[model samples]
Every structure is written in C-alpha cells, then in structure tokens.
Target chain A: MNRVKSKYLKGKEKFAIGIDLGGTNIKIALVSKAGAIRNYLKIPTNTQQGKEATITRIKQGIYQIISQSNLETRSISGIGIGAPGPLDFQKGIIHFAPNLPGWEEVPLAEIIKEEFKIAVKVENDANVAAWGEKTFGIAQGVDELVCLTLGTGIGGGLIIGGKIYHGKNNVAGEAGHIVVNKDGPLCNCGNFGCLEAYSSASGIKNRVSRRIKELKISDPSIFYQNNFDQISLVKIFEQAREGNPIVKDIVEEAIEYLGIGITTLVNLLNPEMVVLVGGITNEGDKLLNPVKDIVFHRAMRYHVADLKIVFGKLGEYAGVAGAAALLWDFD
Target chain B: MNRVKSKYLKGKEKFAIGIDLGGTNIKIALVSKAGAIRNYLKIPTNTQQGKEATITRIKQGIYQIISQSNLETRSISGIGIGAPGPLDFQKGIIHFAPNLPGWEEVPLAEIIKEEFKIAVKVENDANVAAWGEKTFGIAQGVDELVCLTLGTGIGGGLIIGGKIYHGKNNVAGEAGHIVVNKDGPLCNCGNFGCLEAYSSASGIKNRVSRRIKELKISDPSIFYQNNFDQISLVKIFEQAREGNPIVKDIVEEAIEYLGIGITTLVNLLNPEMVVLVGGITNEGDKLLNPVKDIVFHRAMRYHVADLKIVFGKLGEYAGVAGAAALLWDFD
Candidate 1:
C-alpha cells in the first residue's frame, strides 16, 4: 500500500471514527481532518430489535469499517456518534428520540467507550451535521455559522467562533420550534406557528393534505396509502416543477414560512454564513433563491448585506465527518 | 487620600473615562475597573451648535470629571464612548442616529483619540450598556447573556462567550427589531410588527393614544399632557402602579410584546441569563415577573429551566463601568 504524505496531514496523520445513527440506517466512517473519508460502511438500523441489539449493530458497523482500513485501530483518535434528540450532551445520553424506538436516556457514549476502550462523544444529529459543514463543507474558514437541516422535522445547529454553542441543557439551537406564525398551525411540540410546523417535509405534506381535503379533490389516497411511505419529497418537487398547481401552492407556502425562519435566524445570529442541508435542500436554487430573497428583504439591511446562504456541500457524509472531527479534537 | 489595597485591585488601579453621548446631554465620568465611579460631569449637547462645538463641550466634560478625580491623567488607561447608531465600530464612525441630530458618519473615536492622545473605542450605546450589565450588574459570572434596554426605541446587545458578538457589520444584536407580531404594528424601521414597535415607551404611548382616539374619549390628550418640563417613563409607571386602567392596559400590552422578544432571544441564543435594563425596568418586579412568566411559559421548557431573568443592578453607572472594563483590559 502506498502511504500519501502531505502538509495538510501534519506529522502523525490523525484520524477518527464517526457514526451517523439514523432511524433507517447506521453509517460509520473513518475520516481525516481534511474531511476525506478513508473507509466507510453502512447497515440497516434494525431499531425494531430494541436498543441493546441496535447498539450491538452500531459496534459491528464501526468494526467492519475499521477492519477494511490499512491503518491500525490504535492510531484512530476517538469515536463520535450523532443521534436524534432530545439528548443530554453533558451526560452523553439520548433523552427521548421519537424516531429511535425504545431510546430514553440511553448512555450511548459510555456504552460505546466501554465496548471499544476509546473516548466517545455524542451529539444531536443536526448539530453534528452542522459541525461537519463548518469544519469541512460550505462554512469552512467561517467563524460564526448556522446549519439548518430540513427533513421530516427541521433541525438546527449553531457554531459561534468555531465552536458548537450547545446552549444551557444542550437545547440551544432548537430553531425549528421557534414560533414564526403564532396563530398559524399546531406543532408537534404543542406550540402554534413553529417553523417546523410549516417548513418540515411532514409539515408540507400536512399542509398539502389539508388543502386537498378543502378543495374536495379526489382523495389523493395514494399519497398516504402506505403511511406516507410511497410519498416522497422528490415526487412532490417533480409535480411542482411539471406545473401541478396544487403542489406549487403548497411548496410556495412552505417557502414563505422558510423565509420567515431564515430571516429570524439572520436577525438573531448575524452569522457570517448560513448553510442549508438535509433532504429538502436537494431542491437546489429553486428553494434557496426565494428563501434568500425574502430573508434579505425582511431582515435589517446592515446585517443581511454580508450574509451568505448556501447549500451544504458534504451531503450525507456530514454527520460522519463531523463526528470524526469531534473525536479528532477531543482525543 | 487613603487608598486601601484590595484583591480586586491587584495592580496599580487604572481608571478610564466614559462618555454617554445622548441627544440632550453628554455625561462623562471617571470610572474604576471594579465598577466604581470616581467623578462625573454632565453638559448640554448643543447639536445645532455644530460638530466642533459638540466636540468642545465633550472635551470640557471629560476634563471636568478628570480634574475632580484623585487619579492623575497619565494613569488613565483610555476612554470609551457610547453613542446612538447605525455605527461602524471598526472604523469608529456613526452612520446616523435619529436621537443625535446631524450626527452622520462622524469618526468620533478617532477625533477623541487624537485630542486626548489615548486609545478610544466607540460602540453603540445599547451594546455598551449590555457589556456594562454583563461585567458588573445582574449578568455577572454569566458567559452567554443578552441585555435589552427599553426607551423611546428598544435596543439590544448580545454578550456571547464573555465577549460582545458583533456580526459581520457590527450590527449583530438588534433583538428589538425582530418581528414577533407579523401583522401587529408598523415600526419606524419600516417593518411591520417589530418588537420595538410594541415594547418601547413611545410604542406604549402610541398604543394608548390610539385606544383613546378609537374610543372617542373626551380630553384624551390629558393623559400625555406635559405635567412640567417633560413626559417621563416614571410618570407613566406611576400612573399604572396607582391603578390607572388605561395606563395599566397599555403597560401590560408592552410587557406582553417584551415577553415575546425575550422568548425569541432565549430560542435563538439559549443565553444563560437575560438582563433587562433602562428607565422602564424601574417598574421592578411588576414588569419583570410578567416577562419572566411569559418567556418561561413560551420558550422550549428544557432550555428555559436554566435561564435566569433579572433586572440590572448597576443603574446609570453601567455605561461607565463597562467602558472602564473595556479600557482596563486593553493591555
């Protein structure tokens, strides 16, 4: 095997392991400080097998990735895991993640450390993605940045002065639940008019379903036939792009709320850059341009002038990369 | 004079001059690092007298305060001036201040530094007050804090990681202008439903005046009629405290909007503490309790549990203390 040496690698060539634990899959990867993925592996989460079984799968995934690498596991710095929240980062516990069955105050970091005999850190998945973006993606070299992940639920992570700002109780960056329209819609968090209630994929679906019901359109029962399984965001986007008026209106409404949320973040953080990530961001400039335009128009001109809103470059690897970076820094 | 040695005064006690440049008056003081005010002087700010005359009066005010202090001029570290914005902190220029007539892009910091032969820093008055509160008042020992000052207009400052978080253009924290009520009221900034449009003293007066007009009450103007030389916040607070129905309703309405503003800050920064300062806070527990109740009730519960809300304790000396601390740390 040929060993590559470069200035960016430094002397020891530090490396770390990152695990992105999602509802459907568990992805593990070994990453370098330069954001290069050396070896990666993925496995079905099998969350239905319960927490203990799922934890075992996660360990196996890590081992599988490391075994494929030429570098010794000893040289691997530490391990970082990104899981859904609400989590207690200080305690390294997953408080209660709706997506992950039977996850309640799971001591994830300690469990992984005990199994592997290495330092382990855990953070909310969105925060980890933000960290990944800041260190390796669009926000590289920027001091203050905010990353918003638009998926089933809206998630946000704030980086201030190059460090993750986990507010008191590790819930500081819950931008999704921030009320944009106090009288708009009922949110899962029992709040009215939260950005998540309008901006999330599920939020969009709910809005569309409501509008469809009101218009007495032949029940698009196919949309919810498989418990929303057959309904994909891409399908909606495709329809909207093809001039489906109903889909167009729903997407436009979501964009309006997204703009409000973006403006709020701009006014509040005044960050150098705002990086948008997750499944919804795949819509590209179609969604980004309107959101940017409205945010700039609504926010104070002084704060908005230098603001840069861009799509996250790291894609699905963001979590694993960010987790690896965390290990590299702490270990 | 006997100078008692104390732990707080570890080195040769340094002093700094602070200038609060208001529309009506220029208040200058000699301040110690431990939040002590050695001497103070106030002078009329004759803006129509032109920039030169105003600068001359400011210099006189500084000299008068310094002369009254036991400290020598050579021992003074520097000077910190708090002025109205929009300002360029990096260039030390004030773009325009509505309160300060004819103040446009004035290089106040450079002018003062040149005259005194000492380093000078100029910041937005609200930001200075925030630093003042964080360094010596209610937010002492808290690393992440935000201070809100309510007057004719609402002003804000953000203290993140123990340093003021000035955004890309030095306009990071304009919390008052964050739109809470999207369809509520028109703000002077040309925005609809800004927190400043609802919470400021002038905002309260406007809301009360509108109600009186809508009700067609005879002698509606009597409520705001000049009792003596001024219409002060103290007068309004007294009327509300003494059970004036109209004034009480207006104050409650303002407090409701202020609560929303505070909740927005909590949601955004997840600050460890939020301190309320300015003339309006003189309502004490009456005003603070309602705001606290609303913020706690409305914000993410987990994030709000550790959040502390308190009234500023430094009173009028906050600017002087903050300025002194700024210079003392100048090295």
Candidate 2:
C-alpha cells in the first residue's frame, strides 16, 4: 500500500462512502471530505441473480471496509451512490437502468438508508463524473463545464453555476442525443444523425469495419484481411500511430463529427471547459490536439477565446469521488 | 391612449425608461413595475451622423418622455437600452454594432448613468425581447423558455432558471450561428451551414430568387416574370397562401431548415416553451403549425411532451417591455 496522507474533514473527522454501482461490479470507497480515498474494495454485482442479492453484496462490501479500517459508522457523514440512470434524483429512485435489469423505480436510496441507518443520495453516473472533475480533478473551480464519457455509448453532463444542471424534467444533459448531421446516420433513440452515432466506442468500431471493407475493395492485399473481427479501437489507434491510411481516415472522420458536435455545444452553452473521460483519452494529444484544432476553428471566436479543452484527471476514481461529493451538496 | 393600471413598485411610485435602439430609429417607452407602458415615442436614429449624435438623440428622447409624462427623474428606477450586440453587458459598452455606424466600444451605459444619475442596464435586443415576453406576455410565469426573432437575421435568447444565461463572456445566446447543415450555406459569421443562412428574412428572400430561377427552367410562366426585385417576404407568404407551387416549395424548404435548427435546440435545452417573434410569425398557423409538426416529430419525445410553441403576445411592445424588465434584475 502507498503511504497515504490523511484528508479527513477537520474539527469532526468526517468521511463518506462513495459507491460506483455498475452492471458487472460495485466499487465502494471510503472517501474523506478532502477527497482522499482511505480504503477501497470491489465486489462482483452478479445482478442476474437478483437486485436484492446485489444489494446484499454491496452492503457486505461496505461493512468490510469499515471493519478493516476500524472506523465507526457515526464518523461517515453519508453514503452516495453514482448509478446508471434515467433516474428520479428528487425521490432517490432508479426509474430504469439498461445495464441493471429489473431496476424499475427501485428506491435504492431508501433501501440503503434503512439498512445502514445513514443518509443516502443517488445520482446519475455521468453527472457524478462531471461533479467529480469539478471537485477533485483538472476542472476545479470551473463554474460552467461540459464533461463527456466516450465508451460503448457517449454520455454527457453539464455543470452550470458549479452544479449539475438537471433540466426541467431531469433530462437536460443528453448531449449525445443532440443531432449534429440531419441526414448522416440513425441513432439507437430512433433519431437521425445524433452525435453518438459517430463518436461512441461502438460508433468508432463500426467505422473501422466499414472502412476496412471499402479499403479491401480498392486494394485486395490490405492489412487485417482475415482478423477484421478482432480489430478494436485500441488496435485502430495503434495502426494509425504506425501510419495506416485506412485507420487514419477512420479516426479523422470520427474526430470531425465529434468536432462539429462540440462546436454546436459551444455555440449553445458557451461552457468554460470541456472535460473528456474514458479510455479514448489514453491516446492523449493524438485525440485532444486534433479535437481542439477543429473545435476552435469551427466555433465562434468569443465563445472559444478562453475555452479549455482538457481531459478528466481523476481516472477510475472519478466516479467514486463524484459520488462522495454528493454529500457536500446534501450539506 | 388607453386607460392603464398601475404596476409600479409596491412601496413606491416608480417607473423605468426602456429604449429599443435600432439602426433606423430608437423606440423609447416609460413602463411601470407590472410591465404597463404609460408613455411611448419613436425617433429617427440617423446613425450615419456618428455615435455622439445618436447619443444626443437618445438623451433628448429620454427628457421628452419625462416631460411628456409629467414624471420626475427620481421616480424612474433606471434606463434600460436594448440594442444590437456583440456587447459588453457588464460595463454596458457596445462593442461593435454593425447597424449603428461608428459605435465601437461606446460606453452608452456610463454616459446615460452620468446624465440621469440613475441606474442603467444594456442588453442584447433579442434578450430583452425574450424578457419582455416573460414579463408581460403569454409566457409570464414560464421559467424555461426560448425566444426567437426571425427578421433580416435570426436572433435568440435563452431564459434558463428564469434568468438570461450569459455564457462565460456574456455572448452565449448566439443561436443564429448554430450550424444546422454542415455544408449547406454560408453565414456572415464566416461559418458554413448556419441556421440564419436558411431561415432569416434575407435567407427566405434568397430562397425565392433561387427557386424562381430553377422554376423558370421547368416552367416559363411563373408568378414573377419580370418584377423579381419587388419579391418581398410578404409577397412570398401571400403567394404561398394563394397556392403557388414554386413559392410553397420555397417556404417549405426554409421552414424545413428552421424546423431542423429548432429541433436541435429542443433536444439540447428541453425548455418548456418556445416564443416566436417577428413578421414571419404573422402568417400565424401557416408558419407555426408546420414548424410545430416538424419540430415535435423530429425532437425527442421527453423534451417536447408538454412543450408549448406560441407567438409572443406583446408583439411590438416586447422590446420596450423587456428593456424595462432589466430594472427588476438590478433590484
């Protein structure tokens, strides 16, 4: 273990249990008010077994952390859960979650609060990640910021006036669903030309597949002729780095569509910074430099004059940290 | 002319002076706290004479209103000006208003405040109109509303949480610049495929010219055989109402682009109401019914489920009414 410094809340040594609940696994962390992760553990959700079973495993994981750290439950201010959403944050109910089946209107907050006898808060996972970036990441103190997660599907959250902006109906930050190209492509939401159709991990993979087929027609002796099914976004990035024309074109097209989407967002919201997360940022300047170049060139001057296009710094810990930040809002 | 009720400040008999400064004329109105206009007047701006001359005209107008209404300056809460923008709202400086010559970085607010010894606020004309709709029109109690003015150019204002959302630099609501078609048409802002390029009054007129030329090739005896220059937006609307296929196609094309642009806004902002302003809306359901149908059909269901698309009720009074509403912000 690394020699960790104490970041407990002063005067009363307070802490929060941050739960990043997902389909495959549940990550529970003991996070101090100062944003230090004192103890952490992960447990398989096994959600297929049932919601109650997964809840039991989560509770056990929480108790395990408390016992290992020799801390009293009284010292923990609250438990914050950042879960997949389409949720009712006001009522602390999970209306529906695609990843976790049978999560229809489950009062997750109430269940946890009843079991642990501690205050609990539930929020959208993407929103928590945005708040996490603001609280303990590179975007600290940025009152107006946009955060995007580029994974299987693109999810986004807006931070306005230093808080998550849930629209009139709690569905405000659906940036992925905003149409970029009116006739470009169809999205899962049955909309034509959504930003997600060209920018998500799946979107990128589909591009790779289509580009390879087009290349094979032009040149019969192209690379990855037989192992096309194994061609991943990582392999595409590696191939682009190694100077493959087909992969380069694919990456450029995706980034161009992403740039157009971001330009629309800049025109509309005029956010101070746009923070990116997920595995795509591992490409570093390869992704950020081109996106910045295109977005700046396309967006209006005043809106982009002081804009910062950066990556989220907290890594995997962002979700848990943001969840814990919910306690601050509760206070 | 009409018997008006007092909407003055509850504790004090106070009113506000609202000036709608335009390229050709300046419309000034004395308005009570409840958004009732007690006195109004319009004067030629003669902007070509210079910024100082225009300032003098505006000052004289203010004095004339005070004298005509038999109201003392002390009873006026503030002077609010709604002018063409790219402005510095914080310092009340007009950065570069193209409509008004030699008006770069002119400190209008400071000069007005010094002369009147009263508070003064300067805002984008479109923003003021939106505020006016909220204060005195159909959207009086609607907090989240989007107001659009479709004239020679399209201007938009967003009321988020019941306040004007000034982006990081107070230039947030440039909705006209939002790209609807990435490769469609050129905008004055040097961008390709802007909403303004396809939906503005000039845009509509240009569509008529292009469509007329295209129709001449297919059919010679079209409506405007020789007098194309006299083909105004009103004429196009009138012709379309008469069931002219060429004119109808032109109007439908413009409305289609407008609908696409508005659909993007609905998906992004999820506002409760959208208020339409300007002459195009004078066509009533001819313009609105089709737009509403297209927009609702294209936009996400949740965003438009309970949405109300209506025309601004205050009509010409919106500018001055919105300007007066600026005083409420100061309070």
Candidate 3:
C-alpha cells in the first residue's frame, strides 16, 4: 500500500513536489498535474552541515514553497527527487554518490516520505532529465530516446519503450563510459578511450590546449595576438566561430568523437531520437550538423534514417522537471 | 483477440509449438509449460521455392511434430517462431530478411495463426535466444543480460529489466555493429570497424589468412609441415590447441577484439550477466578466459565488479528453445 497503484487514479488530478539535489544547490518545484511548475525555490545544499542538517534544510524549503504559494498540503500527492547517481534507485538509497560525500546508502526517499507523509521516489539526475524530455520536451511522443548531458562530465539517460531503463544495478545508460577509441585517451573512470574522456567539456578543453600548444610551438606569433592563458570551452568556441583554423580543428575533433560515441549508441539501441543537453547546445548547427553527418554515415542505415538528433527543449529546468516526471510512472 | 490474455490462462495447461526458421532449415518443437522440449523435428527450408512454399513447409513441420508425438491438437494453444531480423516483431511481419530472400513485410505470425487456428508470436532469432537464456539458460534469475551469438556473423540480444528491449524501430540490440576500432576493418553492413568485422567467424579467418601470409613471407620453413592454402576458424582453433604459435596469435588477436566489444557492452549496459553463443563457445575456456581477462582489466571496475561471462547452455538448439521461450512472455 506504500506505493501508488494505477487503478486508484480513475479521474482525480494530482500534483507532486520535485527536488533537484545537486552538489552546489537544491532546487524544489511544485509541479502541477499538467507538468507545469506552479512554484519554485532554490537553496544551497550545504552538505558540510551533514546529512541530518541538510535534510532539515530540504524540508524547510518544501514547507516554504508551499506556504509562499498558498497551496494546501493535501493538494500535493507525492514527492520526487533527482540526485547524483550510482545509487540504488529502486530502494531510494544513495549508494556512495561521488559528489555527495558521506551519502553512502542514505535512505533518502524513506526519510522524505516520513517527513511529508506522502509517497516519495528517487532517481538518477541524468535519468530524471531524460524523463522530463520524454514527458514534456523534445522527446515527447518518442518511445525510445538516448539523452546525453554534455558538461564537465557526460551523463546519459536511456528511455526505452517509454520507460527509464535501469539495468542490473540501476547503472544502465552509462553511455559516457562507453569506449569510443580503444587506445585514444585515459578517463577518470580508470578506463582508456572512454567517450567522456574525449567529448566532455574538459575533454574538449584538453583537445584545444593540445592544438594551441602545437600551433604555438610551430608559430608563436599566431597566438601572440590572443590571451593564451584564457583557454576555455567558451573561448575556444568563440575563436572557432571567428574562423580560427586551430580552434576549429579542435572543435571538429571533439565533434567526431561525440559522433562516434552517439553512433555506437545508435547501432546498439537504435533509439528514435538522440537529444543533446548542456552548454554545448549553444553552438547549435556547428556541433549538431557535423555530429549528425558522422553518425548517419557511420551507423546502420535503417537506424539513422529517421533518427532525430536535436537539442533538449527543457534546458536548465530539465533536472527539476524530470524529477517531477518520475511520478508519471505511478500516475 | 489475436493475443491471449494472461487472465484467460488461470487454469489452462497450455502448450505451444516453437519454430526456428533459418536460411537453410526449420526447427520445430512442442514446448511444455515448463520450458522443456517435448517433441522436436528439423526440415530443410528450401526458401528458393518462394514464400508460400516455405510457409507450407513450416506448416507441414508443425503437423509432423504434433502427429509424431501423438498429441491432441487442442492441447497446443499457441505457436511461436524465431526468425531473422530486422523484422517488426510487434506486428509479426518480416521487414526484410537477408537470409530468407523474398520475405519482405511478410505477415508470418498471422499466416501461421490462420493455419493453426491459434495465437502466434514472431521474434528476432537473437532476441529469442536471449529470452531462452533468461528463461532456461545461464541467465536465469538475472534481470539484465546481453547475449552475443558469434557465427558466420555476429547477432546480439539485449534483455534489460528482465524483458526484451526493443528500441524505437525494433532495430535495437544490434551489438554486432558496434564500432570497436574507429579505423579497423569494414563490415558487410556497410560500416567500418564493427564488432562483427573483427570478431565474427569470417573475421577470424581473414585475420588468420593475413597472419599466415605474413609468416610465409618471413619464413616458409615453418609452414612446410602444414597446408597453408586451407584456412578456417575450425582450423585455427584446432591448430592453436596443438600449440601452433601463428594460429595461437590469431586466436588471441580475435579474442582481444571480442574482449573490447564485450567491454563496451559492459560499460554501457552494465548487465548482470553476458552469455556468449555460437561456434566460438566450442573453444570454451580458451576464448572465455582471455575475453574475461580483458573485459575485467579494460572495462570500468564497478561495472564489471560482479559480471558473469558464460556460454549459452542450449548450444545449437538455443534458437529453437528461444523460439519456444517467446511464449513465456504471455504465460
């Protein structure tokens, strides 16, 4: 009786509170029955205060959001959370999240349920974003999709057959760890040639640095006009946009690696859509077009024939929305 | 209703006929409620006679299985078939089977249902094998598994969350087409560096042929004791078992490629178990041990922490058993 059953929802409308637990901050939102955010609040996570104090802060944030919005507590049916992963999603326990120290086997959902007196569900952050995409964003109406969150580290979400696919250990859809090249580069995950090691923000930065160093070594005068120490993804993209050949080549190389990784997913999963979510989306066609070219030309014809490679529609709110989207399973 | 409802089978002792339709032959079996084969028979496919003739042969095979077993026709409640892909399993239609020429969008399940007056299900051969493995093979009790069939070509089956994972276009689980090496050999599927191109039977043959040619050019005296013109996978394994250094190197090289491919699967899927099927299994420990070594050493540690790599238990009859295992979905 703890879990909501589908048969109970004959005609009733229900709303849920969504919590996005990140390393720096926590974002809480009152998601309506129609998946619209009626109220939102942001607060620093302050994990240094320890687990009990952090839980207290989250509960306070929830109460504040409800009081500020003047909404009745009875109106909220459940609570959903999206948190850093490698956790036991089914058990709603944080099984040693790297970003959240001292959060080993933390019974998050159980505690939240106790505090709110409502059903609570917890999922991986990347998977929550994917659920948000499938329910309200670009992947709407798509039964199968692979969403990649390109940032300092790449995160993946696999929506297969209209549901988040949690494999044996709730570790499925680890596309970032997929090896693009057998002997390319070493990853922090202690693997060689992983997709994240080549296509992530840091990966791109490293590539650009290598290219700049090579160019500087060959012709020091070429880089004297620009601030070489200001090396970053934004700077590299800006330089590439201005037709800097070295920066452009670096961008192209990273795109090729991303395309290879995506192509691998296309061949293995054959998803209907592949949505890219992150700061990289700002480059638009410069990143998407070439990645699409390599994926289409490299993957099996039938798989890529109708596959849509697009940017995520939810943007920054994807995590919050996707966290709320978790209730869709019960609703 | 064309499909049987689970509720309708509350008290019925239902049985099913399982058929594995391959390019050269058809395997038919009467499967009981316990995933056991009661009666079995095999017949040549003779696909050249056209689709209608092939259907007739399949129908005849079914009748033979029933009549020979002296079983009541009413006892068999349904029929299931495992056919080559990439077919529309949901619709029971063959999109285009390269092996079974002339089969294009063929309504196989409906045709068989009409003839037998029973519910029928059709699935991809690799998927059927995966289901069979889940039901009665090494993957029993495992919720997530990846089954790889290595023969003339490589075929894959993805069992995620204890169910067959059919992505958007029913073309998922094409693990054979995964790019292991970006600039390796070309595959018949019109892609370069595919797992199939390096780990398949023909791929091994090509590698052995190249190794033989290289050895011959360097020193013909080593090959004077054996025939160099005849080269095959069977020959390579046989020679390697006798401590032939050249053949041992080729076998090891192929195993290295297989390891990389399996490592990729491990990192992406994080399956609880990986069941490898085909002639390669005949090599047994020679192949399994080395592949396990590389996968454990190369893949992410947490992903491969408790991974199980084993051979399919059903052997050549896996296709037929898998075909029968399709009924477990309904049961």
Deviation of model 1 at A201, angstroms: 1.7
Candidate 2 chain A lowest-lDDT run of ten: A1-10
DockQ of 1: 0.51
Candidate 2 residue pairs in backbone clash: none
What does candidate 1's lDDT look like per residue over A1-331, in tens digits? 2134433345557888999999999989989877899888888998899998999999888777766665555667889999997788776899888789899889999998888788889998988999998888888888788899898999899888778887766777887876776567887776677888888998887777777788888856534535544566666777777878878877776887788777777776788898999899888999999999888877887778789999999998999999888875531
Query: Tens digits of per-residue lDDT for model 1 on B1-331?
Result: 2234433245666678988887777878888777778787777898889877998898888777766665455567889988887798777899888887778889998998887788788888888888888777888788788888877788888888788888767877888787776677788776677788888977776777677678886854446546533445666666777888867877776887788778767876788988888878878888889999888877876778789999888888777677666665531
lDDT (C-alpha) at residue B98 in model 2: 71
Looking at every candidate separately, what fraction of the true A–B Cα contacts under 8 Å does it contain? Answer: 0.51, 0.51, 0.73
Q: Name the docking class for model 3.
A: medium
- Candidate 3, residues B174-221: lDDT per residue as tens digits? 988888877878788887888888888877777766766776656433
lDDT (10s digit) by residue, model 3, range A34-122: 67887788899988888778888889988887665555555566788998868788889988666677888899999988877877889
> Against the true two-chain complex, what DockQ does each candidate achieve?
0.51, 0.62, 0.62
Lowest-scoring 10 consecutive residues by lDDT in candidate 3 chain B? B1-10
Off by over 4 Å in 2: A1-12, A207-231, A238-250, A329-331, B1-13, B207-231, B238-250, B329-331
